[model samples]
Target: MTGRITFWFDFASTYSYLSVMRIGGLAAARGISVSWKPFLLGPVFAAQGWNTSPFNLFPAKGRYMWRDLERICAARGLSFCRPDSFPQNGLLAARLALAAAEEDRIAAFTQAVFQAQFGQGADIADERVLQGCLRVSGLAPGLVQRALDPAIKSALRAQTDEAIAMGIFGAPSFTSGAELFWGDDRLEQALDHAAAVTI
Candidate 1:
């Protein structure tokens, strides 16, 4: 049996950027099928009585995270640049990613967005940036308009609700059947669990 896992991420999550860039190759190597699920963290954070990213709510952790991210990106040979904004609004990006999923271009589109934001420090909330990402992913920039469809908006909302129900309090989460793993560092453990549980 082939392993299968669902990757839950928010476009604004710094750790999620790491997993997004690396999950493709890792999953392919282990012959694990991946489902890229884009969700918003705002609601989840609110549920926990927080008004913003924990990185912002806690300054010390935020400082450590940025430096840690820098070191990790350097080690992996991936570009790293802190965006002017800690958490750029990702509502538009998430919707577009769902649109890309329909055409089976989610992986490419997602990587492009992450690179644009974390690698080049672009503002993902900007439609122009999103359109550029779409183009580079070999998708039509017009999808930006399509992403505004009511159906797309509702889908994103529903996805976020689902994430909450799954007990996913953070981005870069993975689920293998009923097992849940959080954080980029747990990625391999999640994949291994999926593979081992395959029947």
Candidate 2:
């Protein structure tokens, strides 16, 4: 049976990076159509009285998370680097993603940004880095100008608002109907739930 899933992610989330890289192939194998929804975690965290990532807020947690990420990346044969900044500003990237999603280039753009940030330890907030990502993704560089459009900015805000309305509080969340699954570990479970449902 065919199924549908909405993937909600934040550009700066480490675990989200893992899901972004693998979800596409895994979902395709299960006849599940995936929707890439990029949203900001700033507002969500603020709402919960967090000024930063829980990993950053709690040193013990932060240490554990980095080690966990290292293990996960090694096992998956993916590059891993701890960014100088824990959560880089993703405003520009989110706007660009919305534009890329429209042109059916979300996968390429998303992976490029993730790789740039996590794989190369580059700052994603830099316009030049983003431009490079656009180039590597086979998307026209002019899309960067489009990302500056007011409407695109508004669309990103709307997406974040929608995510909040859907009760999302974290990244790499999967929604199958009203069921919500959080984290990379839950990806397959979410897909299975989607597949089992007759939507």
Candidate 3:
């Protein structure tokens, strides 16, 4: 059986960066389609009484995460840098991604934004950086302005709300049918689940 998996990620999520860079090729080999679903972690965190990422709320976990990301990236031959902000503002980036989704440019834009933030330490919230991402993704730079539209903003909010309703509390989560898998590490398992399901 062949099926698709929804990849729910937040721009500010480091592990999400890893998953985003690798999911395409992996899923393709397994004959599984991927749906890139970008959402905000802010409301999710807020609902749990936290204003910041768990990495920031808990110091030890935060430190380990950075080191862990470094090792993972190194192993994968992907560049890695620690952004000044633990969890950067992903609002604009998420909005842009949703806008790009209409034109099937979400993959390009999403990767560019993630690389800009986690690979180069660029601030994803910076308009200039986002404009650059749009250009790099072969999309019109004007799309950046479109990302600010009320509709795009609402779409992002709706997506986030959907994520919450789906019981997604973290980024880089994957879902195949009713099976939910969280974290970059679970990517293969999610794909396997999708591939094994009877159509």
Candidate 4:
């Protein structure tokens, strides 16, 4: 009963950043295979009648999230800097990720983009940033071009729609069959459940 853990993540979410850099080693030890599924949270918010992040909609939660992000990053010995744009554009990043998905470069693509946005304060929507991330992964410059093809673009959109239908209201979601867990905090529990099923 070894289950593959589907890691549903969004680029703009602070908690997702935490999960991205840290989930790999832990899952490796637990014998959990991680499938990085990047999606856009913008449509998720749009469908809920919101135009911005919940953090921005509610200032108090937003403030606490920033502070929490700092402490979490510090504990992990990772740098933290909130991007100027509350919810940075993730469409390009997510599509690129899906493109990389074809080559098993999802992990590298995820790491580079996360670091670019959350680690170095770079803009994810910028073609330069997106290409830079890919170059580091040895992905060809035309990769984004190929990812932008009509077929691939539709697939990415369908992926996001599927995420919304799956009851995912937040980023860094994890799912195994009928079990769905949201947040980086639930990562370990999700792994435990995956392991117990096989045992």
Candidate 5:
């Protein structure tokens, strides 16, 4: 059996930005098929009695995260620009990613969205910005309308629920069968586990 990894991410997550940008190349090199799963972190945080990103709730952690992200991006040769908003509204983006999945363009669309938000410091909540991301991903800008479909909205909600059920509390998580790995730094370890188990 071919190795597989389920990638769980939230659009507003800074660390997810790193994994979304790098996973494609890494997975391909390892012959691992990636299942990109987009879900909301808001509900997950709410369940934990938090209303905002931990980075915001803890100022020192937020400061360290930004610097760490800068160093990692530099080392990886990836662009990194801290968004003006700590956690940009990603509800719309997550819905649109589900829409993209129907056409097998989710990965491209995801990378575009992350790049626009973290690379160019764009506001992902803006429809215009999302439309531009669609174009970058070689998808029609009209996908924005599809993202508004009731089915898509429900699907995103369900996906978030599933993430929580799977014990995922953060973005950039990976799952190989029953084994779950969290954080961007753990990506390689997750991939290695998947390759070893072929799950």
Candidate 6:
């Protein structure tokens, strides 16, 4: 039986960067279909009475998160530049990715966006930056404009609303039925659980 893995990722999330880089091969080996569902965690946090990443809400943990990211990226041979802007606006990027999926190029788009944000320190909110990402995926810039259309915006809004309803409060959340898993650390377990449940 094939299992569906709903991946709730936030582009600004560091841990999510690691998962995106790693999950593909892991899921393939397990014969799982990884559904990439990108969404913003900020709006969810706002509703939860929090203003920022918990790492940011706490000074020491925030500091440690930075240093830890540097070490992890180094170990994985990945770039670790913390963008001057924390939690770069990812709403538009996510919308564009969903738009790319409609064109059958979501994998390329996802890789490019992840590399642009986590690897190259590119500004995700900038139209030029997004266009560059789309170009890297061999996609036309026009689709991004389409993603901003009323129809797509409504879809994106609905996705966010559904995520909130699913008890998702953070990026890197995963779900199999009503089984909710939050955080990048839980990604593998979620995948395994979904696969096992399907079996």
- The candidate scoring highest on lDDT is 1
- When 1 and 3 are scored with lDDT, the better candidate is 1
What would the TM-scores of all predictions be?
A: 0.98, 0.97, 0.97, 0.95, 0.98, 0.93
Better of 4 and 5 by TM-score: 5
Each candidate's clash count: 0, 0, 0, 0, 0, 0
Model 5 worst lDDT window (10 residues): 190-199
Per-residue error for 132 in candidate 1, Å, reads: 0.8
| 6-73 per-residue lDDT for model 1 (tens digits) | 99999999999999999999999999999999999999999999999999999999999999999999
Tell me the spans in candidate 6 whose CA falls farther than 4 Å from its real position.
Answer: none
lDDT of 4 at 177: 72
What does candidate 6's lDDT look like per residue over 20-127, in tens digits? 877777888888988888877888889978888877788898899889878888998987677777778888888998899788887678778878887888888898
Candidate 5: tens digits of C-alpha lDDT, residues 1-199: 7799999999999999999998999999999999999999999999889999999999999999999999999999999888899799999999999999999999999999999999999999999999998998889988889999999999999999999999999998999989999999999999999889853
Local accuracy of candidate 4 as per-residue lDDT tens digits, 1-199: 4557889999788899999998888888888788888888888989999999999999999999999899989999988877888788888888888999899999988898999898888899899999999999878889988778787788878878989889999998988876889998899998888777653
- Residue 139 Cα positional deviation in candidate 1, in Å, after optimal superposition: 0.6
Report, for every candidate in turn, its global Cα lDDT versus the true structure: 0.96, 0.93, 0.92, 0.87, 0.94, 0.83
Worst 10 residues of 1 by lDDT: 190-199
Better of 1 and 4 by TM-score: 1
| Clash pairs, model 4 backbone | none
- Looking at model 3, the pairs that clash are none
Candidate 1 TM-score to native: 0.98
- Quote the lDDT for 38 in model 3: 98
lDDT of 3 by residue, 21-68 (tens): 999999999888889999999999999999999999999999999999
Question: What TM-score would you give candidate 2 relative to the actual structure?
Answer: 0.97
Q: Candidate 5's C-alpha lDDT?
A: 0.94
Worst 10 residues of 4 by lDDT: 190-199
Candidate 3, residue 102: CA error in Å?
0.8
